[model samples]
Target: MASFHFELVSPEKMLFSGDVESVVVPGADGDFQVFAGHAPVMSTLHVGVLKIAGNTNAPQRVFVRGGFADVNDSGLTILAEQAVDLAEVKSDQLMQDIRDLEEDVADAKTDAERARAQAKLEGLKALQLAVAH
Candidate 1:
């Protein structure tokens, strides 16, 4: 199968950089997949798991807090706020983090702030569910 270069980076470090057969990204609007010769695009990502398929040990699933995805002449690049490999994400720790986010939702001062916090909480909930499988 043909492949394309894919890179996933967070503030701390680059989590992945290699050729991939395909990549499923959680776009702000919805989930989308990219393949070789895909049209160039810039998309804002939502909190969700990024699925990478290729010559990997197993299908890679990485949790991304939120980020931007860019596909250009070079390849696909993900600039994530925070990212963790599903295999490395501890369920207990994730639940506790969600609890903290729930508090933020409750403590939100403005309607907009509350909405934002709620969205983030929802994303985390979705991530937790994905990691379960």
Candidate 2:
């Protein structure tokens, strides 16, 4: 099977780096898939799950806060502000975070602030779905 080098990196550390058959990323516009020999491109990413199909038996999942994906002849590079492996994510913590965001949204004084909180809540819901499976 054909594969491409996929690297997920954050400012604090390198999360995952390996060769994968394909990757599904949450592009700013929507979701997009990348395969081996994919055309070179760059895009802004949203807060959502990134799924990578490696050579192993199971696929890997990572939740990214926000970032940019740079795909080139070399490979795919994800520069994320925050990224967490789904396997390592704690459900309790995530639930707590969701609750906090909900409260913030309720108390939000301005439309912009409410929108931001809503976005955060939506991201957390996506993360929950990713972690569930």
Candidate 3:
């Protein structure tokens, strides 16, 4: 399979930089895959897992919380707001966060607060499902 240079960066640091066969991005509109020689494009990413198939290492999955993906002649670059290696995520911690957010949702005093809590709860659930898979 053909490979292209791919980079995943966040405010804290560059998480990934390598040649990859393909990448599955969690675009805001929907999921999309990019390969070498893919059409040039830009997309906003949602809170989801980004999958990378690389040349040497085992396939990797990283969780990204909002970002932008830019594909051009050089390769694909993802400027993520936050990135965390799926393997490094502690399930217990995630579960605790979900439980806390659930309580926040239930205890919210205003409509805006409830909405914010609900959205966070949904994102956390999605992350939990991703970890399960």
Model 1 Cα lDDT, one tens digit per residue, 14-66: 88888888999999999999998889999999878888998575339988887
Best by TM-score: 3
TM-score of candidate 2 relative to the true fold: 0.74
Residue-wise C-alpha lDDT for candidate 3, range 3-92, written one tens digit per residue: 999999999988888899999999999999999999999999988899888655633998888889999999999999878888888999
Off by over 4 Å in 3: 55-59
Q: List the residue pairs that clash in candidate 2.
A: none
Q: Global lDDT for candidate 2?
A: 0.87
Residue 84 CA displacement from its true place in model 1, Å = 1.3
Candidate of highest lDDT: 3
TM-score for each candidate, following the candidate numbering: 0.76, 0.74, 0.79
Off by over 4 Å in 2: 57-59, 97-126, 129-133
Candidate 3 structure lDDT: 0.90
Q: What C-alpha RMSD separates each model from the true structure? A: 3.3, 3.4, 2.5
lDDT of each: 0.87, 0.87, 0.90
The digit string of per-residue lDDT tens for model 2 on 20-130 reads: 899899889998999999999899998788888865633377888889999999889999977888878888999999999999999999999999999879878878877
C-alpha-based local distance difference test score of model 1: 0.87
